[model samples]
Target: MSDGLEFLTVEPASDPVARREIVDLLASCGLDYEKQIEFFVTARQEGRLVACAGFEKGIIKDVAICQTLRGSAISLRLVSEVTYLAHSQGYQILFVYTEPHNADFFLGCGFYPLVEVPGQTALLENTPVGIKNYCASLAHYKVEADKIGCVVANANPFTLGHLYLITEAAKSCDWLHLFIVKEDASLFSYHDRFMLAKEMTKDIPNLTLHGGSKYMVSRATFPAYFFKDKGMVGQCRTAVDLLLFRKYIAPALGVTHRFVGTEPFCDTTRKYNNDMKFWLQEPSSIAHSIEVVELERTKRSGIAVSASEVRRLLAGGNFEKIKEFVPKPTFDLIMNKYATSV
Candidate 1:
């Protein structure tokens, strides 16, 4: 509705300069613009980038506007355009992460704030299924009080390290709720990863598996969390995710303990684990405690066994090397279903 405002969808490949301008604008606003830059909407005033919003799948991120245009309708128009684009692409549920000061603008744009990390970040969603509703559905699967443990994993291809973590966590808790990352944003399909996890862990009697809904480290969280980007962007994303879990998911399931494997490699994951330890500690953040278990080392190479390593082996046609890291079920699936041609 703002006069002299022009809205354009800037593709990173086609309009690299415009994309760089948008990224610079977002970076000036303390937002990360490194990831999910493939498709974005920008508002220009007389050819100057004034406002912008980026989307990846159902997520709306890297939203920014020039300080002078704060009170104008530019933000609303940006949100509307991005939301419409997401809906047109078949995304029924959309999420946006914004700074606390800018919460009201998005709230007016029909997004409800789910959780906020004080001065850091706020998670909001524009959908019929709010956080409360989604958490409530999970409540139905709640176990006995103070006896449950949880593990949120992507299982890009469920590795033996994952199996070891789950098995060890199950040994200490009465019930283990394994939430497989349901976001299909990785090399392996969510279905394949989920099924592989189920098949491998089926023998563990006390382990219960659930899909890591959007509330968990899915599209709702910044994609940077999965990547190598470290610093405030990664920290904020990790904090918001763990905050959501500690506030909504943990309490609902009576989860007294959350378990994660120690990251010897990925700095992003290691920082995430460190943040989890700080955020979930008693009398400060949440009631649940965190356990950082040691990662399983490969039998042959003595390095940490990880999905990334498995993928590397697969890519290099070193299928035999992957058997040391991934579970038998995962190896079978990759060899038979996915890597048959290779």
Candidate 2:
């Protein structure tokens, strides 16, 4: 254990350096020591290893890396963190194998027996790794609520600008449902990033967190290959989001308005906003409805607050610049995760 056990937050699957520490953490947690693979790590206050987890790509196995000292419980946190990390990087299920003695540990982590796997040993178990699974059956969908607002942003690391947009939207709405992108397409992993956003705004009244799903923002909906397809993907994504919200979620949940943060610089968001506004407000789009509330920028460091700039600053290691773009908890999580990963 190091001097002042600090829990450093690692970035996403893209980081090269932090990946090494993750390898070591895997070994510490008694897992395979595969190199050139990607994962994330976190530690305790004294800098001792508290908890660490990661996702494997190109394979559907839900099994991951985790280290919880004897008598310590990393259940909810570890499972949720891995689920967020996995889904962000394109994973659907998490599988695990624990010795009979550790069966208690696994069970407490929400693992029920998956006796259907056909193995005589019966070692295979399946566990959900994302909020969509957790909330799909439990989350109360609103259908006729008064003053409903929706906001979506990839808080790569929460910044002050995000706070501004959220606060500004809160001004007119009765409840603010923030949809933080859960996929880790950026420098930070989904769990670390989402947890930051959650911490920062947990104090706000009537504010809820929404984890994005493929049904809403997956390859089937927002394909990444569109990166080279010029602008095909963006328009397609906007259309998918519009269609899904209008056709599926809106009717079940009485949503009257969606809060969109204005992009002063990014062309992608500008276009997304335009298409979104038109589809929601324009009539004849029978069955497609809901008011689009465009949120103005809350200035920070003279530049408009945006998740893009926040990513830019984090990549440059500018902790100071990040302070203005995200919420405090989000900023801290980004700093810790970035520091450890970098």
Candidate 3:
């Protein structure tokens, strides 16, 4: 086995750093946490309390919950424990909003992705970090006609990488649509994801973020079995979903340029990305797909960081892998959740 980092759990809403970390992680993942869950902590593994994983009490309502720190195997073990605990306590299932990269990982954890819903992306509370109030007052309003860039992220936890994407997208566009997917409706609700996306991207100039209420952010947009059906393999040619989105959602929001990731680890994304290129390349007024590369990872695994890979490591019970992908504050929050589960 790999050398693992110790785990730690914090009291709910305590430890300012830990709480903030959770906020950041969810924001990175695009799940609004402020109004979604009743927080709890799990076991402590290291001298430093890392919030590995946490759970929502009782049965889930149309929302998903965080299960563990990204890329931590111990966290996966902890999530399993929480599953048993929640089940014994009369809980039906432990939910998580995740990217297609980790679909196999979750299946290994015994989580069967729902075919109908895929996973829901939630809107966060009190406006996401960097969004403007221009779009907030209007409920489900479309963006300006003069759109430039777009950030299409699962925003699984709304991290700095997300912020950077928005920051970069806005630099080139007059209007940036930070489309936070209500992806993989798991424990974290769609509202939370949107809200978190808004919060994190709020500061970016010309950046107007919105939630995917129609489920564009979700795997449901493409097909069932997100992980298995991720990027390259799924129904090729026209995503149909993206085309439908271009027909319906874009005009409403006035999205001109659609920004996406250049990360290749996610096979499903690779597939969808091809469709995005094909569609965007057309005579549409929208700019070509803006492909943003990963910020850094110059040292260790030359492979770019990804939510799917992160989930895989976490579900596999690995910790060291997370350190490379997530921030310290974020890592701490996940560890705290792990402690609570144990």
lDDT for residue 2 in candidate 2, whole number 0-100:
31
**Candidate 2 structure quality by residue, lDDT tens digits, 1-342:** 333434444654566565555556666666664442355545554444555554445211223334335454444566666666667776655544344455556667666543211121122234543323434542475524578777777666566777777877777888777877755565667787677778777788877777765444433333332232332222454564565556555544456788877887666667778887866676744465789988777886578887778777777888876776666677666656575665
Q: lDDT per residue, candidate 3, 1-342, as tens digits?
A: 343554343444556676666665556555455433344444443433344355544312112234454555654665555566566667553444344554555655656543211232211111122122323432255545554556667755544455555677678677677666655454335665566666555567676666554335444344332335332223432344565455445544656667665555765567666667665555555433333322332223665666666566666667777667755554565466542452
lDDT of each: 0.80, 0.58, 0.50
Instruction: Show where candidate 2 strays beyond 4 Å.
Output: 1-139, 224-237, 285-288, 340-342
lDDT per residue for candidate 1 within 1-342, as digits (tens), equals: 438999988776688798779879988887777554567888999989999888877877778888899887787889889988888889878887777988898889999878888888888889646878888899899988556888888888899888888998899889999999887778889999899988988999998899778788875664555554532453586778887888888888888788888777766777778888767763454444555444444344777887777888888988878888887888888988767667
TM-scores across all candidates? 0.84, 0.56, 0.49
State the displacement of the C-alpha of residue 86, model 1, in Å, after optimal TM-score superposition. 1.6
Alpha-carbon RMSD of each model? 3.2, 15.0, 18.1
Task: Give lDDT: candidate 1, residue 86.
Answer: 83
Error of 2 at 89 (Å): 14
- Candidate number of the best TM-score: 1
